[model samples]
Target: MTRLFTVPLAGAFALLLAAAGCGGSSTHDSTGDASVTIRIPDPGNEGLLALGKKDGSLAKALAVVHAKVAWTGSSGPFAPAAQELGADKLDVAQGSITSAIAALAQHPGFKLFAQIAPNKTGEGILVRKGSPIASVRDLAGRKVAVNKGGTAEYLLLKALASAGVPAGRVTRVYLNPAQTAPVFNSGQVDAWAVWSTYSIPEIASTGARFVATGGQIGSQNYSVWAVRNGFADAHPAVVQAFSRYLHDAGVRQAQNPASYVNVFTDAGPQAVSGTARRLTIQDLAQTAAPDGIRPSNVTDFDAVARFFAEQKITPTAVNVRPYVLSLTGSGS
Candidate 1:
């Protein structure tokens, strides 16, 4: 599987590509007429890149010359993208570095390209305000809600163990963040492990308090980028171009905070409206950059991988070096 990281910087290039649509073949021209579509996760939090796209930064540079930009987000698209490279389905897939690893474990077609910005914040444990549960220790013997088949669940498992609670001591009740909230408030679940964007605001509205955050666990747990290996090898130039632009976008997000949030607010859903999403995004953007956005080369990934292995989330730990595509051949 391919994994990469990015930051927002410019526009105009993206705008020109957006105008070209998806009918043409993936041919390159001096004026940049090639078409490339990328899938992103949580498009709502993807403000900086979306802004670059809307402003035509990537399109103008790639469009009509050798590249076109189509932004798609879907979990099911990974396998299809791998099988249909010539059909022009996808060039890049956006997701957490771990998710990319999992994808590779399932389908070893994608390759790691480059590093995107570290999704530094946006996680927290929630409990209704004035509830007797004030900290992670209190979760003992009480039921805790989590999305069963999610990274958040792993995060919570680790966080709880690190917080001095036995993993088996706390009951893990599977539930989506949305479902867990009401049940938590109603006493169906004692506490809920959730991302900050939804959980923080929901807690504030319901007078809840936070018990922990993902950031407390480490940096490699956030989002990253990936591309199909065959596609990256066939089109090195395009991969490099996209990687540079994404890196620049990460720089822009770091340099300007609120502006990035505004970009997402314009196109994102109501759930992230006003201050909640902005705060959450700002929080998540601080986790620190990954070496090409994959865990195979990082220490944090080791801890995370061990946690997953112990949890039996995967049959074995992943070796990220052979899978990742790095400019230097050595990781950051």
Candidate 2:
């Protein structure tokens, strides 16, 4: 049982727990609630977060620290979540290291605490069946779809560089995850660069084929989690507890992806089934040594930061070292 108490005069209380549905950015704020609600971002339709939320595992995990979660789900891109974090609307959210680095370059309101590891599969370039393009090397002078500044764009750029194909030669069609499907399915773009959530489903349904994966492109990008600076300062234990829970769950999900079928946040239970589900399970199981949440990798963070800056995506390269914090110790 959670011991409820009341403070007649708490110094500062900014309660911002929002139902804020997915597919659009919506926020709700209040300061009257006695308990603190840690706001988190997700895609809403599918993810481990949604699964845990649906099955009550997440709530149970947070109850140990006397914290609850206010979920914000959106479907467009990962960059907007940074604005939400800066606005004090989100306490923690997940995105590639590049996204975090770019956000830190401009806002400096969030810090990278932990990361999900072995992000080698599910994100890469996909081409429609019977297409003339054979590989990344063949993408020269082709129209490729990518989410600007998102991991997909980064991967496509890296892959093109690896294949000795100039990005200028390949026209990049910038599209969010939502808009690219129709255009790609209709062959408006020669290929689509995307993450697992879209790539897996797209391939399963439309027979889209991956020309190269992030791993194949030698990408060091990671699925990283970040927390608002003030929120981490005030509630380190909650963040730590949540990280521990995720570490355990990540291990489980990697080992037995089928067990977490109910964690679908979008399609209820049946959203992920058949080949897509199989691919999802196979993708996780393929990670022989899953690196669950651990201390921040400063080198990797700095590298990604510089990569973004060099690509003209950010104003300048952020060291990203100061933003790296140790989960087990005082904020680093």
Candidate 3:
């Protein structure tokens, strides 16, 4: 039996109430009426699910396999979505590679199947204008805002380690992406480690400067899509169809980003401006290997797992390969 865990409804499942009637389960429906419940972050620009919903492409593609998509809104970090998946409340979701690894370490049924290309434009450590923190080395003993176990935390760790700063010296302020901007802008935090979604808008509004970027610190942050293993096994055809749909939609966005005006528009002016500044047509392109899990991905995941273990974020080292789903034969 799958162990069901409870998460704070107000925190993680705040947006989920809107889709209350859309039920989810681990067992695939054998009656030929198959459906998938996917958790998409509000204003999610990284995946095709949101864009496809607007353009009707997702519906058209899933129709080929006689499957349907039930879209649910997600907020904050990927932990909530991962928890929902583990509890059999979600069929598919996307999140940062670090968060996915952390989730897989805790949960047993999740599988990473596809990946989004890494973009270096927006991920970095930001300090307020005229702040004395001029470099990664300056972060020692400073209060830094980062979403715990998310990409921001991972990048901060890598940056600090690379700069020879003792991880224990920095005081980390864990906040959701929504809460990060307010704390950072109000000077409550010395620095904010964030990605494009929060960093771009903050910089544009507050003139915050980048102390160091993921690229500068040699951190590669890739976003990945994952699904429940039982669902994929029981409905391979549906999984393949959804993966192909995402790939095709990603290609379209890469070739013509302007085609996704609705997506940018829905994300708000700040997000719109951020998207324009941080993303390029090429950055949205699907460059993932056919198998989805590349050697570099494995190595990076292992490194993150080891880091988490060293930091006592995880109880033990986790091997990530067994949970990776190879879509090479999916015919996408």
Candidate 4:
């Protein structure tokens, strides 16, 4: 019999142990069918939610192997539950190149198998549309909000440093994206170092503009699908299947940007405008690869590891070369 372990919701991270859940034997059901419960990290992220429900790529791919996939949202990026699932809890965890790198550096047991979204233009320095701060340099001596430990903070630090903005040139206001939006609009912060998706439109409503785009700063970033070391080892075939589905999703996301817009509109609660829709599509396409999977030359994982090391975010520098799994291309 498979033992079931119940976890309280507030436990930072919960261990979902169930025969059909987490624990038990890694075997098929009584109907002689294999069960594949994929805990897609951050399922509620508008882009990911739409992909899982509408794209059908994940469903279609898993069906061929007789697996039943289930979705769950994490409190934040890859949590302890995700690490535990290793390969099982979440076949694929979607995160920015920086986040993925940081996660791996911290855990040392995680590996990324496929590229889900290119980390292009996901971030920008948000100011009023016609704000005086037209470039990253303009933000010197201004208050900027950065989400600590997230891509926003890492990118902001690098961008500011390159712009020759002295450490004290800008006031660093640490806040989660949620809190930053309000403060940014109220002028509590002079500018916001935030993601384009959420902060872009929010700042736009306030007549705020982008002072710097990731592309303008030559920041090449991408998101990836990650798995745990042991999980992938125990179930390489399952990992491959999940990786393929994610790659296909990227293909569909790229091929039909408009269709994806509609999908997001239908599946998401956010009211995306025509202009916003176009921008979102454009950003999505920027990260799309030919086969939807390839080694990223843009992100220097080692450099990232070093950054984390300096910041004391990770105990040691991680060599990501061995852990990176390549999807090659479609059907690879």
Q: Identify the candidate with maximal lDDT.
A: 2
Q: Comparing candidate 2 with candidate 3, which one achieves the higher TM-score? A: 2
Cα-based RMSD of candidate 4: 9.1
Off by over 4 Å in 3: 1-47, 264-291, 329-332
- Mark the regions of model 4 whose C-alpha exceeds 4 Å error after superposition: 1-33, 42-52, 74-91, 116-118, 262-268, 289-299, 308-316, 326-332
| lDDT, candidate 4, 178-209, per-residue tens | 66777877778877777766664664456566
**Model 3 over residues 1-332: C-alpha lDDT tens digits?**
11111112122232222122225423333324556444444535544555777777887866655667676665446788888877777788777888887787777668887776565656889899989998999999899998887788888888898899988999999988887787887889999888876775677667888899877887767778888766765555566556666666666665666555446454554235453444432334423322255566777777777887787667887788788764442231
Sorting all predicted structures by lDDT, with the top scorer first, yields 2, 3, 4, 1
TM-score of each model, in listed order: 0.72, 0.82, 0.80, 0.76
Q: Report lDDT (Cα) of residue 148, candidate 4.
A: 62
lDDT for 28 in candidate 2 is 26
Question: lDDT at 14 for candidate 2?
Answer: 26
lDDT of 4 at 296: 54
Q: lDDT values of the candidates? A: 0.57, 0.69, 0.67, 0.58
Residue-wise lDDT of candidate 1 within 75-136, one digit each (tens)? 33233444443244556765555555555556676766665443334565677777888677
| Residue 276 error, candidate 1, Å | 1.6
lDDT of 4 at 53: 69
Residue-by-residue lDDT tens digits, candidate 2, 252-272: 666677666535532554467
Kindly indicate the candidate among 2 and 4 with the higher TM-score. 2
